[model samples]
Target: MKNKRLIQKRRELKLTQKQVALAIEISQSMLSLAESGDRTLDDANKIKLAKFYRVTVEWLFFEEFYD
Candidate 1:
């Protein structure tokens, strides 16, 4: 499933994909893919995204989606 919360949080923060991707050390395309549920985020990226978004990993990747 797509990471709707992730997308929502990013939008709530008024962040562009590039801004978040750069902060998380991932390519914007990769972030887009993950958000769209076309790809899974690895552990490192999951952690980075959770941290950058100020959320828990569980909150970000809920219900074992990419866990």
Candidate 2:
């Protein structure tokens, strides 16, 4: 469940966990957990992240379907 796509997107955007977290108003630790798959992002946060990354929520979270 590790959100490797999320991590990849962040790296592609040249952003750090802290930067993304601050932009989305979440804690860095929470972002870390999401990226690491230790926790799942809530629906609202998932939408926020998708918007922040300029990606569709499906692309961000359900890449298998895209494949």
Candidate 3:
């Protein structure tokens, strides 16, 4: 499913897909796919996103605890 939380968090940080991709060492297209629900974030990237967003991986990937 599309990760609205990820999109929201990225926007809240005033970040772009390119910026987050570069910071996490992934391709911008990959980030785009993940955000769009065409692909899921791998475990490593999940950790990277959590760290970048200053949240836990569970909070980042699990909609049940997103808030």
- Which numbered prediction scores highest in TM-score against the true structure? 2
- Residue-wise C-alpha lDDT for candidate 2, range 1-67, written one tens digit per residue: 7888999999999999999999999999999999998998899999999999999999998878887
All candidates: TM-score: 0.89, 0.93, 0.91
The lDDT of model 3 is: 0.92
Stretches off by above 4 angstroms in model 3 are 65-67
Span of ten consecutive residues with least summed lDDT in model 3: 58-67
- TM-score computed on alpha carbons, candidate 1: 0.89
After the best TM-score superposition of candidate 2, give how far the Cα of residue 54 lies from its true spot, in angstroms.
0.5
- Please list the C-alpha lDDT of all candidates, in the order they appear: 0.90, 0.94, 0.92
> Which model scores highest in lDDT?
2
lDDT-best of 1 and 2: 2
Estimate the overall C-alpha local distance difference test score of candidate 1. 0.90
Displacement of residue 66 (Cα, Å) in model 3 is 4.7
Give per-residue CA lDDT, model 3, range 1-67, as digits (tens). 7898889999999999999999999999999999988998789999999999999889888986745
